[model samples]
Target: MKANIQYAILIAWGILSVSCKKDNYKAPSGAFSGRLVYQGQPVNVSYNDVYFELWEPGWGKSTPIVVNVSQDGSFSALLFDASYKLVIPAAQGPFRSLTDKTTNSDTILLQLSGNLTRDIEVLPYYMIRQTKFTATGRKVTATFAAEQIIKDAAAKDIERVSLYICKTQFVDGRNSVATKDMSGAAITDPAGISLQVDVPALVPEQKTVFARVGLKIAGVEDMIYSPVQEVAL
Candidate 1:
């Protein structure tokens, strides 16, 4: 009975040693970073709403590693050095996906080594331009221009244009202290559009606010936005 117990203890030690070896594998050391851009400009979207995927194809039953794009349209991931197929899934943003000439597909092949920074270019339906913000007493006004980028058969009408103001830099549809919207039909001159909304009393009573203009495309899930601007009250 004593000899049988000694053999069982040896077997248990071997199993634990193998488990520790598997857990000691090195972590990913490569850094991959990029931004979504349109015509050399960042295509800002709603926070945590837009994301892309990286698929490493060598292993069988491959699963996509999801990377979330920030509000400023940037993404970063630490990965093991390998070739990955980058894909922005269909119907993700308020823009059309670019085609990869080599594959004639939506997937763009990327080879990452150490640190890589590449911009993923997309075609937006409309871009908010020339945004200016000002505060007069309790009211804040935002003026901006909208330029339609897609004029072909794929062009989409604007659902609405909105001005958003918040105490922080995260000024969007869902997160704002004040917001105002303008209908698409009311926009006769796309070159010049303006909106005004009254700022409310803050809990801590601050004098600075961040603002931005967002243009929602008809039938699109996401809205294209301008860079955040600071307004002084």
Candidate 2:
């Protein structure tokens, strides 16, 4: 009986060891990088607000790998070398998601072997252009043109334009020290728009601040934003 129990214990240990080894696979070795582009120009968006999904099929796994786009509209991910179905969920950004016809869905199929770089095109409702930021005394002013890019059945009216200023480079509606808004009704000319926000006293006292202009569509949750600009206080 003692020999039999020892033999059983050894078999169980061997089983557990093999299971652990199978589960402990190597990390992903391939990389996927790209940008969200419109006419070959990168679309600037709020950091971490926009993302895409990558689903690796044939693994009996339905969960997706979420990759967030950077402020400059670029994204990078380390993935296993396999076939992936990439898709951007509907109404997830300031722009419209492109649908893939072959899959009859919004997914774009990718066969990544080592490293791949491809820019995904999108149609934005509006593009903030010619942004200029100036700081005078305790106020920071922003001047930009809100160009309507979509003018069809999918076109949306402007909801509001905002000027956001932050002590750091991450300037947005949520991470700003000062902000100013302009209603859509007040905007007479889309080509020329101006907004000003009073800067608050920084706790650490800094001479420079980062700023950007954001354009919100009437029914859109994500606002199209301009590139970050540095201004001296």
Question: Top model by TM-score, which number?
Answer: 1
Residue-level lDDT tens digits of model 1 in 70-161 = 88998899999999999998879989998879879889999988899999999999998888888999799988899999999999999999
* Clash count, candidate 1: 0
Q: Give stretches of model 1 more than 4 Å off.
A: none
- Model 2 scores worst on lDDT over the 10 consecutive residues at 97-106
Which residue ranges in model 2 land beyond 4 Å of their true spot? 101-105
Measured on C-alpha atoms, candidate 1 has an lDDT of 0.91
Clashing residue pairs in candidate 2 are none
TM-score attained by model 1: 0.95
Q: Model 2 over residues 1-233: C-alpha lDDT tens digits? A: 99999999999999999999999998888899999998988899999999999998888987899999998899999998999999898868899976667787678999999999999989899998888888789888888899899999989999999999988888798889998999999999988899998998899999999999999999999888999988998
Name the 10 consecutive residues with the lowest summed lDDT in model 1. Answer: 54-63
Candidate 1 clashing pairs, residues 3+ apart or interchain: none
